[model samples]
Target: MTAVLATLNLGVERHGPWTSVGRSGIDKRPVDHRVQARTWGLEGDLIADKRVHGGPDKAVYAFAREDAVFWQEELGRDVGPGNFGENFSTTGLDVTGAEVGEQWAIGDAVFEVIRARKPCRVFAGFWDVPDLVKRFIAHGAPGAYLRTLQEGSVGAGDAIEVIRRPGHGVTIGYMLRALTTEPHLLPRFLDAPEMLPKHHEKARKWLAARELEKSNP
Candidate 1:
């Protein structure tokens, strides 16, 4: 399958009414030039909240244009690139279905899918939609968060080539569902070792709770 990077986005720091800290880096906009992709994130992108956003495990957030279109119809508005605070707006990419640990090569950088983008209050606040988080969870296409494996320059129109795909079947969609609405699917995350440690911890807790329930009942 052919996938392309439609746009490269960089966030700017802004004070917003809905943000807890009164400041957020959710207002990302498209950039024209090639930007440096570092271990933490794309250079020049503002990451205002380090507590939950921007880390080695969540370096680059990718959202597919196809997925955006789905939202556009539901929202009755143009869900354009960078509107979702994604660093990489992709076309012809099955980002939601991408397996955890799947490696994609774009420009000179290699990125490994690590987790799903969990919708937060900042996201809903950015869009000014009160129930967007709940609706996004219901939609279940939370997009993919990647960790940089090779730092290099990346630009819009870069061809995204899938270099590796783990057969574990733990996709961003499945993981998001497991993490959110479906507790039964949580144990399946164990098959994907490339998943973030926090998820594995959640899976363990779910299992322990289940075991306790079974013994007590």
Candidate 2:
């Protein structure tokens, strides 16, 4: 199945009431090629990482497809690349199922799903929803963070196809849910060999804690 973009959204700097603030221009329907050029031309490759600004975290640069829904309903519009502050907002593909190191080809560019994004205060500030962060954590829909594996041009209506899938069966959603809801059970989820490096770190921490408990007891 192909994941079609139901909405695309974007935000730069803003703060206000949650519902009202969320209804801004950040979430709107995809514009024609002309509109895309004016509002989202920078979204193309080479400039995709411009937002990162050399932060320690890579998640800052991009967001996954599922997270765009919040903006979609908020703005009462079909948001896409130009609206979501993302260089490439896509649909049609199970993002949660995308494994770390696996590559995807969208139009002429290629990107890798690196890890699950961790929402920051900036998101809360933008939406003006105090509980937004908590809700994101609770829902564990942090969305997938990606790195540009290959750079090229991309735009709306472009077909996204999975070029590879990791041998590991665990999905990004499965790991995020485990981390958020049942952190204590994280080790069990790491049974899959394909778990990403971050998940490996979590598993190590859990094992260490368990070992400490055994000795202390």
Candidate 3:
């Protein structure tokens, strides 16, 4: 029910050929002190691509510190906190298992689980791994993209407190799978009202397209 914020990461604009925007906030570095957490995003966090990277629905990304250990073992390297481009690297909570619409309060900030991270071409480019996106998708710990519900200060070492948890069983992992490799499970995400509106639209559109294909075929 509680987790410690292991690291708070913020980044500056960095040029990269991974996106048409030619910039990325993926190169984040850990911040030891508290930072402002706003509805838009962290105060000093770098967001070069508003369209693809930062927005209200994808405000603050979080990854479990425990999951980082798994990657360390799998990749045979030190996958430390903030290495995954998450704003908060945390402990004692299942970030991947976070249900859509789940709410958590840490320090002065409150957040809601809006969706899961979509590892695109930029993600692979950031890591310099051609198959990074595929590997991350298969890992099933894609991390949680959170929407800030309240403006507050968030820093490392603060305890994350869950304020509300939706009963819907659709988690970040399930949402990612449904959106990517598992079309058969799309119904689970589509029917969950707690899911982000955009993702709900995505699943609904995919299902409609499929139905149309069946009829036309």
TM-score of each: 0.97, 0.65, 0.92
Worst window of 10 by summed lDDT in candidate 3: 11-20
| lDDT for each candidate structure | 0.92, 0.53, 0.86
lDDT of 2 by residue, 53-166 (tens): 212224213445666687678546764554334444566666666665566666566666656655555456554566666777776555565565555655566677778777
lDDT of 1 by residue, 7-54 (tens): 999998878788868798888899999998999999999898888889
TM-score of 2: 0.65
Please say which candidate is ahead in TM-score: 1 or 3.
1
Give per-model CA RMSD: 1.0, 6.2, 1.9
TM-score of 1: 0.97
Task: Please tell me which predicted candidate would have the highest TM-score against the true structure.
Answer: 1
2 against 3, candidate with superior TM-score: 3
Give lDDT for model 1.
Answer: 0.92
lDDT of 3 by residue, 81-160 (tens): 77788999899999999999899999988999988898888778877789999999999999999999898998999999
